[model samples]
Target: MSRISHLFSGTALAICLPATAALADLTAEEVWADWQSYMSSAGYAVTASEVVGSGSVAVSDMTLTMEMDDASGGGAFEVVLETINFVEQGDGTVAIELPASTTMNMSFQPETGENVTVAVDFDQTAPNMVAAGDPGDLTYTYAAEAARMALQGVTIDGITVGPQIAKLDVTMTDLAQVVKTTVGTLRSVSQDMTIASVDYDLAFNDPESDDSFQMKGAMQGLKLDGTGKLPIASDVQNLNAMLNDGFQAAVTFTTTGGNYDLSFSSETDGSGTANATSTGAAFDVSIGPDGLLYDVSQTGVDMNMLLTELPLPLSFSAAEIGTRFLMPLQKSTEEQDFGIAVTLNEFSMSDVIWSLFDPTSQLPRDPATLVVDLSGKAKVLFDFLDPAQAAVLDQADTVPGELNAVTINKIELDAVGARLTGSGDFVFDNTDLATFDGVPRPEGAVDLTMVGANGLIDKLVGMSLLPEDQAMGARMMMGLFAVPGEGEDTLNSKIEVNDQGHVLANGQRIR
Candidate 1:
């Protein structure tokens, strides 16, 4: 019976041993230490006081700081957290709680040698973290909370400014990261955050005057999703190596496909008040390793100003407007590519505004439309963000890069009873700046077609809006460059600049 009992006991012990080996005992102190070391490896100076308990650890008086030195002058920033508690769970997980707020202080000086200081306050709820395997990989999930951020102090050029308050309601679904303790590398990170609303109040004193200004702004329903892979290592130093070493990240932000509003109003001590309001404004932006993509639109906008010195208030309104842009992320020695598109649809004016420019109302009351699309390539000499490189370019009195080529992919205008459409391509000669008075000389052609131009000009002349001599000169200039089109009041022209720096219309040299 004794032998049988020993055999059973040994068998049970073997089963338990395997299960225990699968989970290495992790303490709250160990995790906190690893976090501190990881941040230090990433070029931040960190300090903290720790107190250990049975299954938890509390860190107090934590501080992290970094500094930057550049042509725009040097700057430093520091963050201080009052107290943070890390509690270990039975399931091999840790919970981080920061019941107190955090403070960040930043000081910087511009090239003009003027100093500035900005202080901020931030707070968040506790987040749950689970360690994966023995490699220090952490997967964390934070509960949505109404976080508050405030700008406590701002000093610019030695002038002190008043405080600003902001409330941000944020929720994060996932915040996962792989942190290697041995090499101190944050290999990968992914997160999704939603901001329900952001309301702010700002006040500042004019540096050169005795007046003060106050503004209030608010934004609603913003969401951000991002994932990134970093090439960070313990030994990494420069940005070039960090970016070139298989680094890639993409982030996208939107408003949940719903209409949002952003509005602001400002008031001066003695200069009255100004207000601007926008409705149905939507924003979407995406960024990746290679490029950035953005789309912004607003359905309606209104602005009003009441000045103490002016007899009447100024106001204006627009029906719809938007813009889109896509550009490369990194600068290269070779040609870099970029594109931009702008659109203004259904633009209308108030009666008060119209009376100022056209009291007789001779122009048509139709809403105007303006659209443009442009793409181009350019060669960069150095990194524009680098202060040293920018200083060199500034001292030489030259642009950081030279345009290689540009294409007017599309241009359309429908306004004032006239419509114009055009497409063009041009190549710039960087070596011929002197010929164009410090501007790059272009050698290419653009073809344009206009409809209703003649009738529009006739109306202007009949209404006494334009002098007869000026109208005749304009017609003669059009006759010299453009030929009559097949349709009524239509004209077509090709505008060009030759290699010899001569401007031409059609096949004839005009200059």
Candidate 2:
């Protein structure tokens, strides 16, 4: 309700608002009072007119406003609601009714960019929200049959853009949400949300040029789970101090299936159309006192594209794709853990795409795969969480961290008729950077195996894809670095960097 970041919690579609419950049978007045307290604690300036009745309280002309300023810039946001009813159910529960329509306005002034303002309109079909539990630990549950959001207006440096220039609409159906809040030294919130279906359509047109674009998409079985520790004492404008004060969060989002279609036209770039579909996808992110983590994955993806500049259509597919990264953000004297991984499985292109190069079908057509996993440790010289330090580091020539050690957990690649695999570990000597031309000198050994190399080269040569001289040069290089194995068309090699600053291949010194 207060900060811009809260807009991302769980069902981002749900306009974030603060409210609490009670231990005893809750009254309409108590519930309304707790709602004000929760809003103030979350750093929102809340004001409204209230009409008290026998068993209900009518709130009207309500406005919640928040402002944040930092090194980068400053921004202000306001939410206006026409009416909300708080009715005490006779059975120790409070039933909250939200207005059918809500208005949100945002104005931002960046230090280096033009001022911008955005206005959005939110509408829902009779959302049923209820609150129960004690004041210390309150729970709220909400459900709605349908909800919609429309972009009302946008202004950049006093230039207004109406719906004719840019338009957006997002709709959701069968929505359910639950939030649990605990009050203590800090406020802790846990959220779980699910939406049966979602549909979005957007369009943009340039008034100056004949450039235009439109996009439409739909998704099913959307879900989100998230937890966070909020600093109820002060506004979260200073993220570095907030993180230091025990602020942490984790959020995960998933969807069962989705599809999208996109079209663009411009005088400079020409016209194109793209469409894609996927069976499932997932995204996860977490940040705590120690470090940060990010992971994303998608499965069963298919895409098609048509461009006026190109004569043929392009299509591709992949069974699975994934990537992950984990690292520490705080300044540390001791080495901290960090890791990165990537995977692409069963990736292939349509025959029409392949025919562009290998029309004769001289090379074997097979799905390609690639996988890599790496872990390392580093000593951080500057804290990334601190904005001031980040600014200084950005202007410096050197990086903010020093690599201490690295391990290649796995590496595999399979394409066409060739395959390769390897693994290794290494430790760096940071004090002796001159030995490796200002880089930390590393000492390690890696064992590699390859199959079908010579046969693939021969096929390429036969298809005229590789010149005879180039094929001969490639064979010479492979022979110099590798030794023939017992199996046909197989090669094995051991690459090593010794403590004496010597690089070796197959136990023979190369440098």
Candidate 3:
């Protein structure tokens, strides 16, 4: 119902905290006040019926509502809790007791569409939660033997939808979390959480058509940590304003392993079934004074698909997959830093897939890999998240930023019995953008090395995969740019873009 609950449940954050053995005397009223203050600071409208009793405060019909808006439109969420109890635990701590079950309603009204509302039921079994520490600096610890969230129902503009329309259920086992909040000019919150396992199943059916979809998945050993410094007076929905006012947050989530199965049916696409599994996965994101950063990775991933149109099932696997990017969010007069990196390690396709083209198996079934790393400096000319600026950029031909420099830190590709590696650094001259056809003229050089290129080409010709004429043309192109290396079957090339805007391969000028 609260941000705390949301954080500990789906979006997790938890960290170890010091022992909270009774120190200073605490009251239930103080704990309630802190809870309300924390929620209010997070931009939630809080309301409830409070009754005071001996050493406890009973809150009934408590509700927390949040509304979010962006350039297009917005939606709202309402959490209604039947009852909660803040009981003083004699030992300077407060026992926060929640009902066994609750309901959260999410409503959406788009720019053009009927209004819709979806309700989710939340439940916890044998839950234990408590809060302690000073008024402004509080620590909350929570644990539950098991927890579950299931879709209760859906409605269109207050009219209930049929029960068969949609269904979703998720169960979590062995949940534990620790959260610490310090309120001042900035509402600083940090937390850590761990979950032994999570299982989910979802299905959706369109009454108007044969379109339907179903998915089921399970994940194990999830651990996450997060921290945020939110501006006290800024609206949580206004990310641009918050960033300008010194707001920042970061979160890292990881899972030991997971698997999923999905099936879909449609009049146009017919029917299909698919399944995927992974040994582990990780996701990390951060936003701060500098900019935004995002990274995701997975290891030991395999997927199989069967479709009505396909004669045989298609399957593929990868030893590792990952991508990362960092960029500036706010406009700046001077250049800002940015970077992007990608990796696909040991990727392989099933023989059933390869046999479609190379029935004789002329080429090796070795796994392929691709790695790239690019970093650059650019000037953000306008606010990326500002609605007005966004509208202007959409209508204008001018870009929102200007690239100044790029560094190709690394590049590697190994596949089809060939390997290639390269690196480069370039500086763009914005003043001379005309020479490269509106692209800024660059002054830099790139060094590339290739191994087994000729051998792969010969194999392709023998397999009738590449026509003889086409193979000759490819070799001609490679000869124009590359020179024979010291090792047999190796080629090395140096491509450069001079300050005068001339393109050259080795010492030969091509343009």
Cα lDDT computed for each candidate against the true fold: 0.62, 0.82, 0.84
- TM-score for candidate 1: 0.74
Rank list by lDDT: 3, 2, 1
Give the C-alpha lDDT of model 1.
0.62
Residue 189 error for model 1, in Å?
3.1
Where does the lowest 10-residue lDDT sum fall in candidate 1? 11-20
Clash count (model 2, backbone only): 1
Per-prediction tally of clashes:
0, 1, 6
Across residues 75-97, which tens digit of lDDT does each residue of candidate 1 receive? 54445556767777766666566
For 341-369, candidate 2 gives per-residue lDDT tens digits of 99999999999988988898877778999
Best by TM-score: 3
- The sequence of per-residue lDDT tens digits that candidate 3 reaches over residues 239-262 is 688898888889999999999999
Q: Report model 2's TM-score to 2 decimal places.
A: 0.91
Instruction: For candidate 3, give the lDDT.
Output: 0.84
Model 3: CA > 4 A from native: 1-19, 68-76, 109-112
Judging by lDDT, tell me the better candidate of 1 and 2.
2
Q: Which stretches of candidate 2 lie over 4 Å from their true place?
A: 1-4, 8-23, 28-43, 51-57, 109-116, 156-159, 395-399
Query: Quick one: how many clashes does candidate 3 have?
Result: 6
